[model samples]
Target chain A: MMLEILTYPDPRLKEPSTTVETFDEELRNFLSNLEETMRAGPGGVGIAAPQVGRFQRIAIVDVSSHKKVTKHHGRLVLINPEITDWDGFEIAREGCMSVPDYTGNVIRATHIKLTAQNENAEIKYFEMEGYEARAVQHELDHLDGLLFLDRLVSRRHDLFQRKTHQKKK
Target chain B: MKNWFMLALVGQDRVGIVAQITDALYRGGCNLGEASMLRLGTSFTMMMMVNTQLDENTLISVIQPTAEKLGLHLHLDQIEGELHPHPEPDVKIVVHGADRAGIVAQVTGELANAGLNILDLETGVGGSDKKPFYFMQIEGNATQGMEALQLALEKLKETLQGNIDINLSPLETFDL
Candidate 1:
């Protein structure tokens, strides 16, 4: 079953999610629903568990379909995701499902070494760079109850209209 | 029983202006709503929507002294409880080109004339001083529909001699 994506000001979204301690059938089913919800969105590149009203440290990112993404590892379901180390920084416009109708320019690390658990509770680690890295970072922000607006470089200058600034597909 | 008031704080940029004023409000039990603070050129500007049971006279008296001590110009205007005119901008317009005067006036004037409401507008000038660049973005509501508004803005953009990107559809956001 596809899950409902929570919108902004829905106080539940702000609640810092609990870490996933067990990898059971329920978690698998929820992850599947997350994948479905992400794909259902037109040009959706990623999604998080808290967005669906589940306060858990789980997010999924897939940038392979984003024309500019040259290298990607397909669907990435990051459970209890943690960014061990990051390098470099770049400012880019970002939009979130929870905050409809607004997008902001946010500064994020260009490269990241993220550690997360898989469906079988196996710990996995990967080094991601460029668009894939950016997508992963955006999804991770949800777990911390922070939106692109909160991380804007300058609310006055960096916040932009996501629909028009679609220079990237 | 809550009363609403709009407050403006404008003066030389300082470190404690917000802290000083917010402390005053906290002492008087005023809840801050929407607020925008900015620093432009030499002056720092702040505007806030405050709600409290305190009367205008009493609230002003409490804040006025602290504001004066902070060397900030303060103005307070009571907003009627029922006369709220909040307009949410559904369209986003971005303009970029040569820097000069009247860009804002012309663009906003036309929008107003078209019955569109400007929700938020932010503009800046950058590039070499010899050849400055102007950039503007406005979140607005175009009651005339998307196509109509797009055509109207297109004409204005052409006339204004700049690149204007009009995003009529509300942007979609995703979480997680």
Candidate 2:
């Protein structure tokens, strides 16, 4: 089942998701749907429960198929994810499905060590860097009711409109 | 019916400029749309889109008193068409080198020749006054795509010699 992705200006997207305290079969089912929704989107590398209007802290990330990403965790299902530590910083441009018309330059940690729970409620620790780390950070932000617009490094210099290009004759 | 106007205000840096201007607009029942306000050196500048029922002359009259009190140079133009037009910037370009002449002209000229539309550009001088460093960041879009745009910038970098550094990268975006 593919979930409906909430776009910008939807009040639900701004509301923080509650922690997932109970890991059950239903939770597993929703995670599967979240993955489906992610795969359905155009070039979507990740998805979060909150994006589907589910007020639960759940997110999925998979950058294995991305051409530029040489290394990744394949697919990551993070529940109640927390970044235990992060190091370094880099500014890169990003776009979100929620905010489809614009992209912005954002500064994010280059590397991170995080702890999260799997579908079976087993705690897992992981280290991520480069594009994967950036992807995880972007998904985690959705759990907190934050968007890439909120993380823009410079409001004046960083924000840009995503315009469609017309092929020249 | 609401009329739209582009408003520009510049004045020496001081407190209450924004407050006074905004207060006047509020009293005049004018609503602000998109606005950018910043301090450059010892002066403050503001550009804003204003929506109001007042005509051009009346709107000018409303803001003139506040502008005069604040010692601001004011310009207001009645504008037509969409207030928000989408700007497409497909690539991000950063250039830095020792301060010299023709950097902006040469870079922009190359970009224009490559059929790239510059959406946003900002340049600044840093380092010591004795050894000033110039840097510019440009966001642009090209009809030919990122690969061709990168090639053009590379050629321009070579032409500028070793004194200037140019970095061009596509705007990387991931949907989530």
Q: Number of the top candidate by DockQ?
A: 2
Give lDDT tens digits, candidate 2, residues B41-136: 799999998999998899999999999988999998988735556565677888999999999999888877777788787788888989999989
In model 1 chain A, the worst 10-residue window by lDDT is: A157-166
Q: DockQ score of candidate 1?
A: 0.20
Candidates' TM-scores?
A: 0.63, 0.84
Write model 1 residue lDDT over B61-161, tens digit each, in one string: 88999889978988999875433444445667777777878878877776776767776788888889898888887776777766666667777877865
The list of candidate 1 runs beyond 4 A from truth reads A1-26, A29-57, A60-136, A142-150, A157-169, B80-90, B113-115, B126-133, B161-172
Docking class of 2: acceptable
C-alpha lDDT of residue B144 in model 2: 73
lDDT tens readout by residue for model 1, A50-119? 9899889999898878765688888898999999999998765576777765565577889999899989
Clashing pairs in 1: A48-B176, A96-B173, A96-B174, A97-B173, A97-B174, A97-B175
True contacts kept of 1: 0.28
Score each candidate by Cα lDDT: 0.79, 0.86
